[model samples]
Target: MIPSFRLFPDSASTVSGEVNGFFICMLILCSLMAIGIAALIIYSCLRYHRAHERAIGDQRRYNVPLEVTWTVVPFVLFVGMFVWGARMYFDIERPPDNAISMYVVGKQWMWKIQHPEGQREINTLHIPIGQPVKLTMTSEDVIHSFFVPAFRTKQDVLPGRYTTTWFEASKAGKYHLFCAEYCGTKHSGMIGWIYAMPRKDYQTWLTQGAAEGSMASMGEKYFHQFGCANCHHFNNQGRCPDLRNLYMRPVQISTGETIIADDNYLRESIYDPNAKIVYGFHANIMPNFTGVIQPEQVAEIIAYIKALGPQPGAQEPSNPGTAPSTYGAQKGLAGPGATSISGSEVQER
Candidate 1:
């Protein structure tokens, strides 16, 4: 179907109307102020021309109340606008507890998306109407922005960092998607569509893609492949912190600071392991996977870590006794200068 157009893109997202309303209010306030100031200037210039002898007559020394009115009124109006914007900003940045998460990778000229259910899409995002969706995005090369004018949401996807944005489709339809940042040669061509379908239809679309493995499953394989499981295991023998049930949990670091073990934290731990050492673990033990782990693989590892934790209303895993899936394969991958991770091999300083 041909998408409808208006002075503004269809307010198809939960925040769309709110953002548009805020923008309209700002426009009206600014325009009125501009016109008022212009009119006042014109009237004062014409009425108080030097040629008018009576214009000099009635020159009041000072008007304290009028000055106060201008100062207080604009201050109050701006403060109100600031508060409204701050609230919306927090709402947009902090995804809901029950939000459905997805991944997006921005490359030179295309968007690569991955659904938790193992579905994949190129340059298009499929979301269910009336449900909150959180997108964890990154750039493979340079910077790119994930923007949907209809949703009134835009977030920059940066290289070597993860940025997130969330939105709920209030209306079902196809909306424009653009990489708001200038990436490369084909930056303008880096465009797509966001399809908001009904719950059932969305589910169907999800199943239409590859159904082989979830992000967590692929992460699990990489966890074994990269030998991360050997050190960050469930047992006490491993010096590193146990990743099980670690998501959304506050972890104390050696610097005496407590930080949430979120996606960025995990990424940092992999990229620069010594940046924030875990409270109890010795510094400089974990090896950096900066150049070794690809962006997609890092996402998978995060997915696996997220899966290790309890979801909403779910119970924690009662048993985590299984050995690292690659305990034996370590000898092969961990060649000459490798850290020991097996039960009797790993020990704290």
Candidate 2:
């Protein structure tokens, strides 16, 4: 019996061929440069050796064309490589707007994955072929890396922040998943498999074990459970900033900095409420849930917030006065020092 070996992993992603081609080009270029230099050194030694003890060597100083050709040729090739690599990088980093959103939480010895449809899996991911899948990943403990060789995609998952990577599987099969970063004693055991199925089969699999409802629905439950709805009311009359229609919108902070309300901003707002106070709002009003809420719960809460799509015909405020703010004297939910501050007064601050 004979064993078969492969020089490269299966190319199962849209970008895998491009990655392989770029890598081969670089390998060939470097290999040829090395071989050419070695051969030239050998040829020069043989051609320029002294024939007799009194032989005088040619006193050539320098060749302008030769020097310029070597320098300029390598420079152009390197610049071309840089441009090609940069374009590939941006394409990989930016996920398509229509890509399916998935969540991943890295912990010691395991990869916990959740789909928008509420399907949960440990150490295994099921994705659809020919459809882009964007993974919003973070770590609960230490730094971890999400790597799929077949997809030619790898992104670092770090604690206290979110990082994303996307891939569209071109082939339908099972591919290996690995935690590229060395984590703990079970680092070698931290492995998984990605099952890329056809669209119909993937949809069927989504319906099988999703009894827990969608992530947004579960997030809504947590929204009320944590009393987030008490202040962040749906009617836009809450004592705190109205959370409705906040996702992916520009938010003006107290420091006059405008930032997009993305997943990372939402996560930071939950864990460290005072980090970036919304404009026309007082700092230290919202309690920090750093120790109270887990990372997965935070993700769910952000999902719920994202599910709160933009309000119809909700125009952006022309000035600070028109921005949503707490008004009149209402009973406060945020314990002791809670008091209703008028929108006009907060704007002056």
Candidate 3:
């Protein structure tokens, strides 16, 4: 088996098996019902055949017990099927709490993925096996879909809103990831891969990235390049809300609704900022950056924030360092004992 192909239990296959089970039950019922019907037809034909021609008004009879038996039995069987199927539906829709998150962005011609560690890929995804992987996806330009044929999971990716799908690979293998929806002229080429590596390998990969320099740093670099830090910060420094610990916190909206800053909520707030503006921020101040920011950048930012931790003052810079703290400088600040930023180029343009 290919390393990325899931040969074991996965969201797609698990849900598929449940559906197939229902279908198999239906097939069996249909077969039995067919046999009984044939038997009744044959019996009626033979039993009613008289030696001589019968009168025009031959007596006809209906058996209430037979009618009730057939009707009630089928109804009970159907109810049972409904309950079973509904249970599976609910289970598949809600992912486990500890599921690993990967942000997916679908454009007309490509699928971009970002791991929480900030590893970015186009048309490919790397995930650890035997773990629940939840994909929070959105479209850049038009409608698209994220599909993994091996796992049997598909969810539409719409513009101006976010959609999610989750799956767990039972075994590790390379799987085909396709944009199931007709997105554009290049839709057919909108394909990628999913690498279900061992948990150790996944951790190793993450460590490798961090050793090289965390994706958070890369995300911070991109944040400025992508113009996200401009509007999203407070007091014209950034237009939207402060990014310091936005996730999973209770955010009070200008509309007077308090919301948990979860993945879906954050996704919506980014793609459709006017939907729920923060209590102090104005709606529409956030220009729709739908197609501008790449999926990889989004992942890096989220990863960077996640890595920043959840302490009370974690969001803010540690301390004031020095004047002329140029952009893109890795040194934290010019404070005492802080690393110096000497030869770093500050690009204001």
Tens digits of per-residue lDDT for model 3 on 261-287?
Answer: 555666666556688777766776777
lDDT of candidate 2 over 1-349, digit per residue (tens): 6666768889999899999999999999999999999999999999988799999888899999999998999999999999999988977887865688889999998999988888889999999999999999999999999999999999989999999999999999999999999998998898999999999999999888755877777788888888887887655466678775566656667786666677899999998899988777787778889878877778778877766653222443321211234211111222121222212211100
Worst 10 residues of 1 by lDDT: 335-344
Tens digit of per-residue lDDT, candidate 1, span 1-349: 7675557667898888888888999999899999999999999888867875545556588899999999999999989999999988877777765678888999999999888877778989899999999999999899999999999899999998789999999999999999999998999999999999999999888777766698888888899899987888765468787776566555667787665567888888999999988766798888888879988788888988877765533432321111233233322433211222222222121
RMSD of each: 9.0, 8.2, 11.4
- The residue ranges of model 2 lying beyond 4 angstroms of the native Cα positions read 1-3, 45-59, 310-349
Model 1 backbone overlap count = 0
Task: In model 3, state the lDDT of residue 119.
Answer: 70
Better of 2 and 3 by TM-score: 2
